[model samples]
Target chain A: MNAIIQTNELTKTVKGKTIVKNVNLIVKKGEIYGLLGPNGAGKTTIMKMLTGLIIPTSGEIMLFGKKLAETSKEGLKRVGSIIEYPIFYDHLTAMENLRIHCEYLGFYDKRAMIQALDMVQLKGIGDKKVKDFSLGMKQRLGIARAAITKPELIVLDEPTNGLDPIGIKDMRDLIRTLNKEYGITFLLSSHILGEIEQVADRIGVIRNGQLADEVSLSDIRRQRTDYIELLTSNVQRSAFLLEHELQVSNLKIVKDNRIRIYDAGISAGQISKLLISQDIEIEEIQKHTSTLEDYFYHQIQGGDKVD
Target chain B: MIKLIELEWRKLDRKKVFGEVIIYWVILMFLPVFFLKVVFADNPAVHFGESYGAAIDLMLPIQMGFLLFGASLINHVFIEEYKNKTMALSFGYPLSRKRLVMVKVLFIALAVFFCSLISFVLAGITTYGLDQALEVIDGSPSAADLMTYVVRMIIHSFATALASLIPLFLFGIWKRAVIPTVVCAIFLMQFPNFLGLLRITLNPDLFYAILSFLGVASVYLSVKLVNRLGDL
Candidate 1:
């Protein structure tokens, strides 16, 4: 795969505090790559640096196989982005706002304005002021603006924010269509792991301003294993008994009354019997699988200690 | 540069800025004409001179205030996008910052010029009516004097408009509209009296000349400030 965006030892600092530090990232063309992290994890900062909204403290960015600063106009011409909330002139109509954006791009296609509105399903809101739009509609309009020019690379920060379930689904579908239909590359930063999981071909997990891991969706799915969840009134007792008596070291207490066993060698039937014999009442026992959310939390928590 | 100007014009036009501006011009023009006819009817010569002076004097305040307003409007050329986090959308275009700023400034300058021209025309009509009324009652003033008065008023008003560019550029580059607006209001409101007092103590001609030089120098400094803002 051809790399569309690459960063080497990229860093940022604000007011004597490091926001992003020594981060390395790569995004290939025609792929929806997710940048997953919690709030204030420097996702927006990194996006700002890449888009040249903010100067980086150190390191470099390469876009379309050329240095980003070598020809900012050319590099940026291929990129479109929404770094945070969608903002527009409140008094202007949605179409008027998009028209302004088209003008800035020097794109004179008369049909593009309406076509963009159609893509976001906002075609009918003619002459209605943007201040009257709901948050979801505004978000959709933001996406429409970014995609209006049919840019080669689109960067969306928290694109699904303030969106309803249907809106999110529509946005995801639109993103997929853009990627598949036009071969456009996407760099998406989202805290909604499910949305990212549904759309991202690959994921880069950032924690505390550092890239923790980068893995393909297929690889993550293949490597992720299932575990047995056992919910009992006496979790501590069960964990102690399972570990000391049953010699099971892979048992983990997930909650006050829940323990998860990752060892495949231990049978639910044997664990149930052993718990019963130990006078512990097992309320629920079921197999649980790791998901994107699970993987995210695990990686973040695990990386915290090392940093 | 043309493309950027065209884009800003479209955006401003769509938002009814042009309509608002036209309304402002009409008011600036007609209000003086109406007020002069009513207030200065008794003494026609003083009427014509004061009317012309009022036309020029009115612009000093209006031009300064408009500079502040214009700054607020033009600062949005960048600040609004920054607030929206849409700077990337703009910077991602083929246009350079220099071109973008130049186009925006040109558009604003033209708008200011149009407003001033409309006001001047209205003042001219008022003077013509005053001249005819004076001719009917007393002896008519010579065409030469009328021409001179009109020409001087236009020149002074134009100079005031040009001087306002300093404050406009400063406020725009500062990106905080309120700060420059307040400072400009205070300075324009008080600086004349302050300078008058200084002239009484010193050589009045030299003092006025120095003030004029400072005004021009301030405008040049404003352009430099605007150029430096590109780095920001």
Candidate 2:
């Protein structure tokens, strides 16, 4: 897989406090990579470093297979981003803001600007000054500005932030369309699991300023922990009966009170019946299938801040 | 660099700036004559002596008025951008922060410089036109008086342009405080008046040289330390 962005131990420390630890992230070409973490989890810091908004303390950033730094930012022209928030000269109209952004990249296309606005469903509202825009409208216009040049990659930090449900859905669809149709790679960060789950092909889970997991959604789905948890007063006896009498080897006693059976061939009813026959009290039996949220939670809980 | 300057211009509120500059021009142009004719007419204690030379000298101190305009540009270009988080947008662009800051300083310098030069012309014309009607002076402007006016126009305008940037390093870029930046300009403009209160006489040439030095040093430090201080 070709990586559009690769960071080697990219770290940032501000005011004697490390905000982002050694985070080695990879976003492949033509893929939507989502960065998931809680608030103050260094998600924005990482994004800021990636977009050259903040300098890294000790690390290397490779974009388009080229190193990115303060002195060498030529690769940034082919990149677009809106970090933290959608900032604009509030006094200027949406179209003027987009035009100034384009001039920076040396990408001048009036029609493309209008087309990008149209894509965000902001067609005729380009004449409206940004100061008069609501948060959602500003977010939509920000996306329009980011997508105007149709660059190779766009890094968006909380793109759907401050949007309604319909706006969120539109943002998701826009990301998917840009990825699939234009082949524009995206590195987006959001704390909303459902948002990432809907649009991201892969995810990099950040916990305490460190990347705890970088896995494809398919891999997460395949690795989903599905098991039947049987709670009982006597877990040792229940485990003994399941292992010896029922010949169920794929089971483990958990928390000194429950046994989790991973072997799906044996039903929860069958396990309960065997435990009951053995005079072991079966308090509860539940089949658990971990969703993305649960997986994210487990990942975060499993990983702590890098020392 | 020119493109970057153009971007800065587009980023600002042109209408507000133009309107503000027009007001400054109109007010400063009429001020010299107003003070000479009405405020300090033949006042014995004030001792302006009712001369055209004194009126011209008064223009030099107030021409530093553009320093306030400099503060305005700094507010728009530096402080407001930081407050609004728009500086991060510029940082995310392809250009280096140093180059971006250089453009901002140049924009402010150019705007201040040209505005001051134009202000000199307007004030000169207004003072001359009012003097002709009132005949406040004994005779018409001498060849040497015209020479002084021309020379002051060039030096004083240049000094005003540079003086306007006096706050760029301290109040404009470092403190990022709007009120301090404007107050700094006001204090710089009132330096001679403050000296007058203490009965200290300073040479005008030396004062202008110091202001010009401040402008150059401010621009140098701004570009020099952009990497250290330009972070969002």
Candidate 3:
């Protein structure tokens, strides 16, 4: 795939503290790339720099094969973004806000406004003030505004931050539609792992202020393995016995009474025998698969500061 | 640039800020005329000597106040955009930061001008009507003097309006929207007293010249400051 956005040694500093540091990112064209990180992890800061809302202290950003500079109007014209919370004039109607966006883009498409509103399921809220909108509705309106100009790339920072379950589903479906139907590439950041996993083709995990890892969702699933969770009355004793007697080195002690063995080769009967030999009674033993959330925490603990 | 201005106008219009503009015009126009007619209706001769010029002079301070208010209004526009996070959407557009600021300034300037003009015309009509009722002019007053005063009031109002833009722009960049508005209000209230002190301490003619020069200088400085601040 062709690269839609490329950053080299991208860094941003506020006061004496660094917000983003020496980070490089590559977002391919026509793909949904999710930036996953917790709040204050510099995800929004990176988006702000990418959208030109704030200047990077150092480094280079190339959008659509052109470096972003003071005169990089053409590159920006092809991009639309919401840095953090999507903000709009509360008194203005959704359509009115989208109209303003279109005007600024020099796009006078009369149909684009209605079409975008329809796409976001806000077609019926033409005249309702945005202040009266639900959080989900406002988020949809923000998405509509970004898509109204038919920008080549859309950067959304925590788009599903305040959404409910159904709202998240709708947003996920809308994002998929935009990417699949319109072929619009997206760079979205969210702490919601499930939501990101649902639509993102590739994921970039940001920890601290730096990019920890950029892995394709498919590859992550392929490489991720299931582990056996061994619950014993005395986890410490069972863990010690499993490692020493059974020679299982991949023991993860989760809680006071539970130990997870990552080695799939070790059988439950062998684990029980090993625990019994140590006078540790097994309460329950089951297999547990590693999830995206587990991977996220593991990556975070790995000292990945994408600042 | 025109497109950017149009976009700003559309956004303002959608928010019913245009309606607020109309309300401001009506208040500015009717309040002075209503008061002048009610207070001096019984004695027309002494009160009517160049009442138009007097009215125009009266508008100088009011226009100054309005201009200050207008500056605050400009700051509010950006502040609201910032608070709502809509500012990023605007900055994300293809336009340069310079063009964006220019368009916003132009939009507010036009709104101020239009409202001031409406008020001025309404005041003129009120003055003309009163003069007709009293037969004070023997006919309509010479169009030259009326036009002169109208032009002066417009210029004064415009200058005062532009002057307010400077501090508002600075405050909007430095602080938030309310800061500039409050500061402008306080300055407007104290400006007359400040001028009185200047007149007493220095040559009155020189003071006025300096004040006029400062007004012009403030406008230039504001434009420069805004450009330098770039996208916030």
Candidate 4:
């Protein structure tokens, strides 16, 4: 029960083209798991498969400790999702749309409907048609609909898509509140690394239809490194001076001109002063911190095939 | 299953659907009288005005207009949902895709069948009232004629409901094209008239039976292949 969603070798192929390849993903209960990748990285496809919106070509999806298949979709009753984007009958009122969704889930609590609307700050607009709402309101209404049934798992794809900065922050806060106060597990997909970094407990980097890596934000934070990088014409002199004069043993000279110093005790000013005292020409120097953005970029564009 | 079918209606734009149905009803209600009092008034060869029993023949084909309504419902229930990506929302529900598709197919069938049936009753009353005023037909409807009209009304409406779904599997579900679906419904609604113009002699019951068979086949194929084709 700890893992609300477990997929084994989950693959999806459309017209002989593999969209998602052998994705073994596990989303634990009560954790906000973010799927991070560039556009066309199969993040939506994986979310679609996980939510039973689309069937995987070859894989096993274990949801809520039961096998998820076409016949055995009882797992979906406890799941709510917004795949790709929030879709509604635009001609219908927001309350009407939510009512239909609840009816489909066999949920018929009017108070819960009102509570979900109020929870998303969408109160007093339930009678308004979705077509009249702005994109931000629609996104919030989508979350309200998804969270209406108080499902155990809520999967949202790009929940902050097409929102203003304030709307995005509100969405992030609403997601956190739903996850923490309601004890709901979240599986969200976003191309925005900072958004994921802010909300997700763990992040899964998807590249070229495959999960390149899955790591916790805390682990990534722990692995975060700070180093001083310098651009100098004489790379050999900078390296020798830093090693002998400053005892900067952990260092690397990259691209024939840039030296990176990983010595925690030595500052950029100290390295620059040491190099200047040695009469070595110092072009430029700055302290650098490796962040999740760099980690995501490396996973996306660094090693794997990026088709 | 019934609840699922009802949900299909609840999910639709009720006002729009009602507007469409009213338009169909208003036009169809007076169409038979229009044909007798205007369209075929001078055409002595068209003996549909000769008797109530013969008039039933004209009414049967005229009410096939509901076949187009079936097409319209398919557009709303299936095609529009697919286009708007709302069908993906239904797919995410706990129900199987096949079951969901089955509900939609049944909803369309029931809507078309009842709408066509009510249309028959309305057209019957309108044409009769108009006939009372204008004496467009030769005599009043006999009990036999009334019974025959009622019987054919039930059977033909059922047939039209099924025939309307003929385009569902290929046009609605598979291709998801709007124009083609409506065009297919138009062709189906006018099929008998085309056969008449071509001087093709076919049994009416046999023809409806064939159309009903095709409609059932379409529903079967839609339910069977929905899981494969229902991906958004």
Task: Give TM per candidate.
Answer: 0.78, 0.91, 0.81, 0.93
Candidate with more favorable, higher lDDT: 1 or 4: 4
What's the number of clashes in each of the models? Answer: 0, 0, 10, 0
Fnat, model by model in order, equals 0.50, 0.91, 0.74, 0.91
lDDT, model 2: 0.87
lDDT of 2 by residue, A181-258 (tens): 999999999999999998899999998898888889978778776899998888887888888887887988779897
- Candidate 1, residues B27-87: lDDT per residue as tens digits? 6554544544565456555433444344444333333333333444454554454455444
TM-score of 1: 0.78
lDDT for A230 (candidate 3): 79
Q: In model 4, what is chain B's TM-score?
A: 0.98
Candidate 4 docking classification: medium
CAPRI-style docking class of model 1 based on DockQ: acceptable
Q: Tell how far residue A307 is off in model 2, in angstroms.
A: 24
Q: Write the per-residue lDDT of candidate 4 for residues A31-76, one digit (tens) a residue.
A: 9999999999999999998888888999899998899988988999
Q: Candidate 3 at residue A14, lDDT?
A: 81
DockQ of each: 0.37, 0.74, 0.52, 0.75
User: lDDT values of the candidates?
Assistant: 0.70, 0.87, 0.73, 0.91
Q: Interface RMSD of candidate 4?
A: 1.2
Total backbone collisions, model 1: 0
Model 2, stretches more than 4 Å misplaced? A231-283, A303-307, B44-54, B142-144, B230-232
